[model samples]
Target: MPGSLEPLDLGVQIPYHFRCPISLELMRDPVTVSTGQTYDRPSIESWVATGNTTCPVTRAPLSDFTLIPNHTLRRLIQDWCVANRSFGVERIPTPKQPADPTHIRHLLTQSASNSNPYPTRLSALRRLRGLARDLDKNRSTISSQNSREILVQLVFADTGSESSELTHEALALLVLFPLPESDCAAVASNPDRVAYLAQLVQHSSMEVRVNSAALIENVLAGSRTAELRAEISNVDEIHQGVVSILRNPIAYPRALKIGIKALFALCLVKQTRNKAVSAGAPETLINTLADFEKCDSERALATIELLCRVPDGCTAFAAHALTVPLLVKTILKISDRATEYAAGALLSLCSASEKSQNDAVAAGVLTQLLLLVQSDCTDRAKRKAQLLLKLLRDSWPEDSVGNSDDFVCSELVVPF
Candidate 1:
């Protein structure tokens, strides 16, 4: 009943031709196939995309796949909607035609053409970006036209008088396109391109910086070889830029997630792990964890787990005043993945530092660890919880643990 199109109760008679044959809804962006019958663009595109070759209304075998826009019908629909405004009908907007490959190729050429004036080239770039953003078909068309290579050249090779402005525009478009792993690998393998990327991440503009961070995350995730990942991770400029992105109070949430994921990938390398720890990754994550939701909390906590592997990372975790309480508070509170990461981070800290163990105890980690052991957390998390329970109990005198019988009895039976 909810999806029914019978408007008889609304006191307005609707024309039969205004409705799509497939969906029985008012046709928006009507288009006709070779069979001379019209359908809504989305409905017909979906029908064709599913491998149906015949017209839905006429049921005739289709010869041409071209969908000609039925402008007359669309105009009539708009006029009818305007006249029926009191009946709650709204006018549908005119749809732009999808940019074909030939047009996309022309725009690509104009954007990269040296003979064109700076404004003309930039205008072409902006137009192409608009097309890319308009539809998935346009994005695929632009990508198929070798847009990535041109954009890469703009960001890395061009040093023209307006290179910076052009580079930012190209970078924005590049981020929109789905970059292949092979292309990303090729870019990451070059030291000069990597250096340029480092500078771009630290760009004066927030949009540029956010785009650069996203691009780096993509490249880091796609880099096939350890050597390539290490090559990018070891750069002080690159890792520091990523850390600074996390530090920015006004950085977009997407940018923060990208920065955290990128830092996590970089931390896969031993040297980069040290660099991230030194850059205050633990402290920054601790400060931000309060505001993060389940998934982001899991990611931030996981990075903190990776950081706690080294002695200095453990020290950094302890040095942050909120670190122990945050880790203790996170256990059994967020998702199970988050619980595991937080437990793992706390175990690392408690195992390394007596002061951290005492701090964890003071923060009431015993109650959290006891709850973790009883809950249905992961086996790995349970093991860490058990270890933390034993570690905390062993670190304190029997008299200091208080009269909490459940906390003391947790160590007697393994949750396993």
Candidate 2:
């Protein structure tokens, strides 16, 4: 609510009427509520947003939440700023009014109409996206009017014969706000809708593709029924698309993270894990995990652990040239969860082959394991580290390995 105008000289006092009572700053966009009190639009909007039911100044109960723009007061403030230009008070640019609920309703209606031309519907959708991005009030209005359902319906209405632009725009709006679980369930429960989204993950438009990948993740995370989850997990296109996103160099980090989450969700089914392995998910994840700053290391590692539960996942990881070094580097660098997953993946590789064990040792896994065993990571991670130390020690001559102190405890090490 503090005005964005430049500060005025101490000698030049701002008129009391020109200031918002709540912020005590000059009013850039003065608005009067039903209680007859004028305040900055942002300040009063913030107050009402916090569930305040009364006027700040008069303390009167507010039955109406209407904020009437005070044009006269705004004009007066502009004139005052103009008169005091020498005092460093710059004229405030006119502020755009927040979208009215009625206008939002009209746009929603227009955007959802199949009778309207595609161009017309796209225009309405663009405006709605602008409103949702611009202000909290606009989003609330749209959300209250069942925008989620309308957008889902619009996307489902697509028959592949229509322009893809409309479907993409609808998807963009659907992801702009976080849809609750119930809304996600609505999309996930419908086979046609889920199939449409899976297909969209590979769309030519990068924006549309990434949005679809993220929406799939949301649907997976929000699926309440096991049947719905199993249905989504079985989509072969989704698995391939997620792997493609992880491998795509042009894709942004957020998109890659979405793809990773989607992969994690899909691989939850034991049978689907092999499908991901066959789709080269481990190689894509290894590449992603190689760059720590660019992508989510913990999730990428967690998904790797999940993938390694099967023999094919371990074989894929063991064959990768960068697997050992990547896992060795990631240990104890990120969160405790990341350390656990990294250790878990390395252990999976070791359990799979003797060559992988030699690779881990050559890549300096012993030092990392020693440090990991001594450090304050999770108990689960430390137990894995201790088991690794024992495995390495037991595999080779005792004298060739490091001190026995690294073996702080003994625990069974299982492959992820």
Candidate 3:
């Protein structure tokens, strides 16, 4: 015979100590054992009283035996126990392993060559995207040199691709990778890396532009004097390019938003500030705000907010009075979600002086904010309204009141 062993029937002769006493087939909640036999509640109590808990078949001693639990059965009992216990503890699922990078590259290669089935390629790419994020999370598991190599590969892959979506995904991974500050410094210092990022900012894809903007922001935040000076030397040309794109009617909304944020950040740097201002940046922003064709209301609002920070620029334009009124109208016309936030910025600028306060009151912002307080809106709006009313009350000349007590009673009431 090729393979033959007679099956032995030990069902009748098996020792009680060797056989698992718990019902292997019909196991239920939290069952315990005495000796080698399993018992339900009533049987257990009877066994304890009679002292006859040895297995009925084997006659093995029942006393002083271990209470070994079936793993699966114990889980069910644990669930019931938890429900009856304290509410503080919580059970969580374990995390899984990240996908392999070599697998990802294989899928990408297959997708490019059209060698694999379309559906499989797409599925593999999706998995690869997830794996990239996971790898970013566990970046510390890899050596710094390896991490840098991977980052460089991603940068190359992102910029070399004609597919906008894939490039955006690759660029996104750059942000997700948790590099140490020193590594960031190294990236910024490396000429090749800087050139690679600068080129990506000019990519045709708006997603690439946005991600590049974020990369630039992160890099510049810790840039050294030499690097900063190099960037500053090119400020006018860069600002003009970015501002042109921002002014373009066909530019993506997200791209324009990022460009505006990046511009604002650049303007905050002392080396870039004067150059940007001299490049007719202020006039360009004012023109954007005035343009009805642009449909960049959010960009316009951001520009206004950024302009407010540069007091000299706001003053130089002779548009201080117009700023508050435009802001108020924009607030009223826009959704209520950002209304109070817009109002707060306007108030901050206008309330800086008694003259400006008078200008704001004349703009009817005070009455508008007061009406907002009466409406059922967010607590933020109500708080802003209260702040505006207080500012208005405080702006009145203190010497104008003969007695402080009268002013207190008339203007503000206090309850005991």
lDDT order, best first, reads 2, 1, 3
Q: How many backbone clashes does candidate 3 have?
A: 0
Return the TM-score for candidate 1, rounded to 2 decimals: 0.81
lDDT of 1 by residue, 9-49 (tens): 67777788988899877888899899999998889989998
Q: Report the lDDT tens digits of candidate 3 across residue range 16-43.
A: 2222243322123223565544533333
Q: List candidate 2 segments past 4 Å from native.
A: 1-32, 36-46, 68-97, 160-163, 180-183, 251-254, 291-295, 395-402, 410-416
Tell me, by TM-score, which candidate is best.
1
Q: Rank the candidates by TM-score, best first.
A: 1, 2, 3
Better of 1 and 3 by TM-score: 1
| Per-model CA lDDT versus the true structure | 0.81, 0.81, 0.51
Q: Could you tell me which 10 consecutive residues in candidate 1 have the lowest summed lDDT? A: 1-10
For each candidate, give its TM-score against the true structure: 0.81, 0.81, 0.44
TM-score of 3: 0.44
